[model samples]
Target: MPDAVMPREAAAALKGDAALPQKCLDCGQRIGWVELFFSLFLGLFKLTIGIISNSHALIASSLYSAQDFFSSIIVIISMKYQKRPPTEDYPYGFGKIEYVAAGALCLAVFLGAITLLIAATRVIFAGVTHPAHWVAFWAALVAFGANVMLYRYSECAGHRLGSPAILTTSEHVKGDAVSSILVAVAVLGTKAGIHHLDPLIAILEVAHIIFMLYHMLKQSVGGLMDAALPEEEQEQIRTLVTAVDGVEQITDLKTRAYGQSNEICVEIELDPSLALAATAPIRNAVKDTLLKGLVKPSTVKIYLAPAGEGRALASSRQQAVREALARYYLGHVKRHHLEITPSSVALRLTFYSQVLPGMRKQICAAVGTNIENNIEDGTVSVSEV
Candidate 1:
């Protein structure tokens, strides 16, 4: 029931105004409700039929369906947490805690597969017999119809929500559908006096369960690991970061996925002339660009650095101190530059702004304060640019 919208579609769906948190909660709730109904139906029908047929496979399938129903209830409870405001203990928000639900579901499937296989093997070796249970046959047919209907609905909902949990549940339904078919055939075979077929089909159904479990496990693990964004997303992100205005070079770009969303971090080297005051706006612009066109995460971090000059020239005497300061502060006003000029004078030179050029004494006093506090003295002479 999670509405699986692509990044673009999700934005569009929220057009003109922000989408309500309630919308997301409702989607999760609706999906859970549908699954709950189907699960109950499957569980009750299978248990009834299983009892009448004395079929171990039918009984095991019923128990598994019951588990699925209960697990979905857990997911429903977790859905409310998904909407809870972040607290001190849970920082990254509760959105990703859904993955914990997925991991649990994976464990459930794994255990169910193991249990079913073990039970089937025991029944087969124990020479258990299945009766010609007409009631069980009809019940299975009804359950199969329900499975088909639930599978169709869940599949569509899963794709729309882009929820791995819903998708996994859909797949489980599909497996159950297949097993239902095998159950029908085996039941008929038993009724026809071909006694061995029921256990054989049960064993075959175990394979389907195993396949479903593996698929779910892969998805659950991938989310928990914070795996890197897909290749296409990475390429798009690189392009977006490099295209930002004033960015000289980008290094240490990294991205990771949290469920369907992504988080990105990058270190940028820019002209030192850029003002420090400009850092906030530029970082915001980059984040917006990525969110609009490339990757949108709960957060993005941008690290700023100098382009090329100041630090490398620190040991070289010939470099103009004024030019170094100019280049260093080009992109931002808050960043300072220290430069050394004219070799062998053993004197210091400094470059700074004289905001109140008329008050020579105040300017000189301010320059001294700026240097002593912001930079180490004796490295460069201070001068008005």
Candidate 2:
């Protein structure tokens, strides 16, 4: 897919306390209502015709449609709640409710599939009376066409809005479409005197339902667990942040999926002497770059840290000690003793100095302060030889 670049104006529009755009929310809700209506209608129509025509496949397909009806209800409820503004008690908003709804939908589907499986198995052992009526074939065909339209519409809307609930509902509609077609074929086979074809097709429909349930379950569980974004997307974010002008180093980057969007936390190093005012532009640039380059909706937070000495100097306590000596202009034909520990670094310098005793003590104090600042948790002592 082409990279999704949200416009600067649109990103800015969401900066304040506003929720998502009303237009998008309206569209999602409209789609959910439409799905709910069609599923209910199809479920009733198929169930009624399946019984009249004595077709096990049509009955099983009707159960799938019934599951879709309930799933649509959950999707609608989740879409409503997920749009609510964040509160102090739940700072992240209710976006994860979509995943919760998806999990519930999976459970409904699992139960329906199991029920269909048992009924079909019993029918297979019981003997068929006669071929299914031709009216059931026509009903399945009509359900198939309706679901095809719903699937396309829902899939398009889901991608546009980045709504997980809508996307998962679309998958359900797509499966319904496929199973309806299979039901239609089985009905025709029964008319051709293949009595077992009906129950066999019902069993196949159950298998398909279970397969789809597995995928939806996995996606919902990942969302609930706050899984990280895909590796490629994380790399893309890193590349964008590194290209900003003032970022000296990236110390850490964290990304996690929050509902349909991603949340990113990045820590970057800047010049130690750079003014705080100078970092604003760099921060804005990184945020804009990520919003434009990433495929999904995203929120970014950046932390600024002062750049320290290079890795070689940071690792070697001796280098830190030498820097302290140079900074203090300490004159010495000096021998120094160094001690390093996990908690602190200590350096004792014995040197020749012409300075008075009072000045020498002051120099020692200054050197100790310098070492603490540079080595970050350290002490130093200086004495005349």
Candidate 3:
């Protein structure tokens, strides 16, 4: 939604450390803890200096730090649960929990901004003024420098891991450094008996926080709704899948994020005449390529379409009805048939011709393992002709 998001080319430029896993739970956990510790330290340090100096700007910045501390803790907690394998109750796994945590963090930042704005307004309206406290000034300087270092480190980890949650947290740190400088300048202005500058600085910082909150909320909701991958990412996936040795073309590709991880599903075009023996290795090639290059252990479903017959083969009754039953009991059979009652037209599916006898059982096992994949209620009866 926001034009501020990185473009595809820019995001793609962020290559990983050759040694890093496409996705790593340990990396996610480490980044969460790093941000948590950094926020906690800054919050306590700033609060101490703010109270000693009696500077409203310092106090406001410190409260923001406190909010960050809370948000980071939530992230740390989510990272632990988000790695749980998909269960019967939660079929998609708990990766989306990271997005939920991100949403909460945004909410906290927004509320903190409101509170800061209210306090700044009180100082403005009540003609309350305090001299710039030297102690607060020094504290802000140290906080700013520390934030810079943390932001760089977090950014490196975020890109290497391709974790949106980590990337967002790193961006927060960068923004906080800028806010610290603004607060420091306001403190100096207040000490010069220019108290008006305090409210102005607060207003600017609050405005930024409001926009960031909107962005975070939008992204969080999009992930929950299973939004399509950004157009550029889709193109990259397409290029990668099609370039694989045996893939003819890409029919469709779908991607959605779960917390800090990515999931991709692809439907591929293939030559019908290729020996059934060749299909498995080709499918595996596409899968291995994606797993190694793009997503970390993502679920990839490949739909094999015989060239030219793609459309005619898909919606025909024989393929449709038989596919449903095959998916249920035969483990994803290739040969199936269905007849339209009204027209008494017959449709034939020759998927069996696409696989070798030895491998049919394995392929079937994969297809039939998930009964929920059945698109129709279990009612089809088998008949011998």
- Report the number of the highest-TM-score candidate: 3
Q: What TM-score does model 1 achieve against the real structure?
A: 0.67
What local lDDT does model 2 show for residue 23? 53
Highest lDDT against the true fold, candidate = 2
Clashing pairs in 2: none
lDDT of 2 by residue, 30-69 (tens): 9878989899999989989988998889988987787788
2 or 3, which is superior by TM-score? 3
**CA lDDT of each prediction against the hidden true structure:** 0.60, 0.74, 0.66
lDDT at position 304, candidate 2: 58
Worst lDDT run of 10 residues, candidate 2, spans 1-10
lDDT of 1: 0.60
Error of 2 at 22 (Å): 5.5
Q: After aligning candidate 3 to the native by TM-score, how far in Å is the CA of 151 from where it should be?
A: 1.6
247 Cα displacement, candidate 3 (Å):
2.9
**How do the residues 201-223 of candidate 1 rate in per-residue lDDT, one tens digit apiece?**
77776676666566656766776
Write the residue-wise lDDT of candidate 3 on 127-210 in tens digits: 855665788778889989998998888787767666677777787788789889988898888878787886777777777777
Better of 1 and 2 by lDDT: 2
